[model samples]
Target: MKIKLLVVGNTTDSLLKSLILNYKKRIKRYVNFEITELNIFKFRKIILTFSNQIIRLFIVEQLYRDFTIINNHPCHNQ
Candidate 1:
């Protein structure tokens, strides 16, 4: 069974990033998932503003420790 992990968000917080990494590590055993930015248009920001929360919830509700979204980047060791 292939599950897609979509870590869609538009924030740049360190805690959020760490969570994403943790999600990735936990979901690599089931499907190919990665982190991706929610591409909301300039004018459509209003629509996507509250929608991101729904997306996040959906990810949490349906995702397991074996799914990936497929946009992950390497963390810097600086």
Candidate 2:
């Protein structure tokens, strides 16, 4: 089985990437795990239009899990 993670923005921080990679490596021990980072700068235009299909593909490809994590910030609105 293949597990794919579609991250919305490019991770510019090295520390963040390292942490994510560490988790991904741990996940790989039990399954085929992969991360696909979609850069907002490069794909911002197409993302809005293609987002639906992208999610659909993710679900159709294998067992689906959607986890959204949001950090609290002074200016953040949710």
CA lDDT scores, all candidates in order: 0.50, 0.50
lDDT of 1 at 6: 48
lDDT of 2 by residue, 1-78 (tens): 687777665555555556556656645655687888666577344433344434434442223222112222222123
Q: What 10-residue stretch in candidate 2 is worst by lDDT? A: 64-73
Name the lDDT value of residue 21 in candidate 1. 63
lDDT of 1 at 62: 48
Listed per candidate, the RMSD to the true structure in angstroms reads 9.1, 11.5
TM-score of each: 0.45, 0.49
- Give stretches of model 1 more than 4 Å off: 1-9, 43-62, 65-78
What tens-digit string does per-residue lDDT give for candidate 1 at 1-78?
444544444645555556656666566655565656656555554433544644554464346421333334333222
TM-score of 1: 0.45
